[model samples]
Target: MKIRVHVSLKPGVLDPQGRAVHHALEGLGFEGVEDVRVGRSIELDVADNTSDAALTDMCEKLLANTVIENYRIEKVG
Candidate 1:
């Protein structure tokens, strides 16, 4: 099975990388970009029988920092 994990900073957290990209876009003449938030996508190939609970455990344990970030697990195949 194919899986995807989308990790992003939780609301109210400052995103310096995202801010830099937003500033760069404005400098390059891209208008109306009010804000930006950077996130990561992780893809994995696991056994077809892998359960959702196992995937959630992975995210909670190591894939994402639950204190400052949130993660969504997606089954791609």
Candidate 2:
């Protein structure tokens, strides 16, 4: 089975990379842009029998920083 982990900074956390990208977009004369938030997508291949709890555990332990970030697990195929 394939899994996709989407990780991103939580609201209220400052994202320097996102800010930089937003600034660059503005510099390029892009208008009507409100805000930008950067996130990461991680793809993993595991056994079909992998449990949801295990996946959640992986995110909590290593995939995402629970303090300042949020993560969503997606099962793909």
Candidate 3:
């Protein structure tokens, strides 16, 4: 099975990297960008029998910080 994990910073947390990208875009004459928030996506291939609970555990334990970030899981195949 294929799985995907989307990880992002929680609201109210400052995203310095995202801000840097936004600034760079503006400098490059790319306007109209109101705001920018950066995140990451993780893809995994695992046994078909892998339980959702196990995936959640993986996210909670290692994939996501859980303190300043949130994660969403999708079973791709």
Candidate 4:
């Protein structure tokens, strides 16, 4: 089985990295760029029998920082 995780900063959080990218984009003449936010995606291959509880633990411990971000997990064969 394969597990994919997406982690993103909350809507109200300040994203300095994203802001820098946005500024660079504007400087390059890319018009209509409204806002930007940075996030990360992690892919993991685990046994098919891995439990949901264990996956959640992995996200909590290593995949995401819950203090300022939210994460979603998807399982694929």
Candidate 5:
């Protein structure tokens, strides 16, 4: 089976990359841009029988920074 993890900074954390993108967009005349955020996507392949708990453990331990970031997992295939 295949899975994907999406990791993102928490609400209160500052995202410099997001800000840079927003600024670049404005410079290109893209108006009405309110806010921006940056995140990451990780794809994994595992046995079909892999348990949800094990996947959660992977996210909590390595895929995401639990202190400042949140993670969401999706079973892709």
Candidate 6:
């Protein structure tokens, strides 16, 4: 089995890196560049028998920082 985890900043949090990227894109003359937000995706290959509770624990323990970001986990074959 495979697991895909997406970690992103909360809506109200400020993302300087993302803002910088957005400015750079505009400087490059890219039109319609509304907003940019940076995030991370983690892919895990684990046993098919892995439980949802364990996956949630992994996200809470290591995969994401709960103070500033939110995470979503998806399982794929």
lDDT of 3 by residue, 7-74 (tens): 99999999999999999999999989999999999999999999999999999999999999999999
Q: Best by TM-score, which number?
A: 3
Tens digits of per-residue lDDT for model 1, 30-59: 999999999999999999998889999999
TM-score, each model? 0.96, 0.96, 0.98, 0.94, 0.94, 0.95
lDDT by residue (15-72, candidate 2, tens digit) is 9999999999999999989899999999999999999999999999999999999999
TM-score for candidate 5, please give it. 0.94
- Mind sharing the TM-score for model 3? 0.98
Tell me the lDDT of model 6 at 60. 98
How many collisions per candidate?
0, 0, 0, 0, 0, 0
Q: Write the per-residue lDDT of candidate 4 for residues 20-41, one digit (tens) a residue.
A: 9999999999999999999999
Clashes of 3: 0
| Over 4 Å off, model 2 | none
Model 5 Cα lDDT, one tens digit per residue, 1-77: 99999999999899999999999999999999999999999999999999999999999999999999999999998
Assess candidate 2 and give its TM-score to the true structure. Answer: 0.96
lDDT of each: 0.97, 0.97, 0.97, 0.94, 0.97, 0.96
Better of 3 and 6 by TM-score: 3
- Clashing pairs in model 1, backbone N/Cα/C closer than 3 A: none
Instruction: State the lDDT of candidate 6 residue by residue for 1-77, as single tens digits.
Output: 99999999999999999999999999999999999999999999989889999999999999999999999998767
Name the TM-score of candidate 6.
0.95
